[model samples]
Target: MKTSLRILIVGQNGQVSQALQRRLAGMGELIVLGSSQLDLAQPDLIRAPIEALRPNLIINAAAHTAVDQAEGEPQRAFAINATAPGILAQVAVDLGAALIHYSTDYVFDGRKPEPYTEDDTPNPLSVYGRSKLAGEDAIRQAGGQHLILRTSWVYSTEGRNFLLTMQRLLQEKPQLRVVADQVGAPTWASTIADSTALLIERWQRGQPGAWGTYHLTAQGETSWFGFAQAIGESLVRQHKPCAMLEAIPSSAYPTPAPRPLNSRLDCSRLLREWGVSQPDWRSALQQCLAGQA
Candidate 1:
């Protein structure tokens, strides 16, 4: 049953990319490239490596994720997040390879009271959000078999994420203020990578129709305050310093880019179609912390 698929992952050190590397190690001839090898900021440079690899699957896990910084450098954001993905998709099509790309929940404007569905119209609020949405559209337009997995509040033990930030700040300060109005699931990078592996396994077993956009995130919703509190609880259980978390509005902590107040995504499509379910945010947080320790 060993397929020996040639998998080309277009990122190396990112949270999700790292998790993918770990999860897909024995499953394929995995070749991971970092910015040094494949710079997404330069779209023209993407085709050569892809053409050379001629992989069976191309996973574009690289993206410009600096929300606040993207406001100042819109061109750089678009270059990496928008243009490069299109190039990758086209190359994948030419090579007749399946593509898997990651997107964000920021495509929504947070106007809907309910969770966002795949059928919902996208109204991006920030430059970064717009750029990510453009990438999704570009991939679809390339006429290639692809999966655009949209997720929110991504974090891992080994990256520059909210979880690691809170862990550091809690030990440094006595109390921490977190945004309560903005809500979403804090998805662990490992969860995404593992779920993706399962989906790929299904495809290898003749479920090729799973090619499309799907919302993949932790099962429950929580504000930044709730996520911080959960992190604190996990630290306390592990005999680490825990901070007193205070719930504050998004207005209290203004940033350069506007964040969607509602990042909760309806992931029933992933469950119904692929039979894949993610753990609750709180439980995932605990498991992530345990790995860190």
Candidate 2:
């Protein structure tokens, strides 16, 4: 008995949500629910919609992503990032639908010099990290068919991310101070969306099983300093005026929530299972910047 795959994409207005919606276009019957339509902070709000639609797949692009803010509002973060996803996962279990949830590399403490793998124990440093880790645990405990993908440094031209921040700052200021201690891949949401869709295609074809976790990030990594320089370089290539990018220690620019110094996520397991290699961070950045221009 072949069942037509009905897809549901949560978080309609977000950068990742919009990117996923664009990629999933014409793929299947996709139901997109915004926070207004379905408040993730209140998981019960999703029950009626899930019952009405009975989707074959649920892609959770919704999250409480304010890292520093989460430090002061742990309870709210837990409500949206942890508890909400748990309830959704339970619903998916009852409906026999596959749950695709995204996680963050912040699950690690950033103590390791090398890339962290899925097998590594999670030691979240901030409230946001803890909440996301809780969400992962909840879905795992639910015993539902799930694929958990942990990624980092996500950016899109439309969002309030590093790239946009740099673009705006470089326009106004003659010089900028960027933290160089933090290291991670600068992943574009478009690539992440496309890669996720490819994974879903395989899952529908009976390749993906009930449970798995994988890291999804760009091929290489760079410190925040290097990232800023690359952005400046891109601006120059685009014939836009460049700004002076200065690299400073993390200590110089402290935040309410401490960022991980090392965010290198090992994607070997991700590649081994998905059979897809991540695109280079520089190349991805080039396309993204060009699109913005």
Clashes of each: 0, 0
* Cα lDDT computed for each candidate against the true fold: 0.92, 0.88
- Candidate 1 lDDT by residue in tens digits, 1-293: 35769999998899999999999988889999999999999888889988998899999999999999999999999999999999998998999898999999999999899999999999999999999999999999997789999999999988799988988998889889999999899999999999999988888888754678999999999999988888887778878878788899999999999999999999999999888889998888878877777
Model 1 CA lDDT for position 169: 97
Q: Which ten residues in a row have the lowest lDDT in candidate 1?
A: 202-211
The digit string of per-residue lDDT tens for model 2 on 139-183 reads 898877888899999999886898888887987899899999999
Q: Residue 287 in candidate 1 has what lDDT?
A: 84
- Judge candidate 1 at residue 259 and give its lDDT: 95
Question: By how many angstroms RMSD does model 2 differ from the true structure?
Answer: 1.5
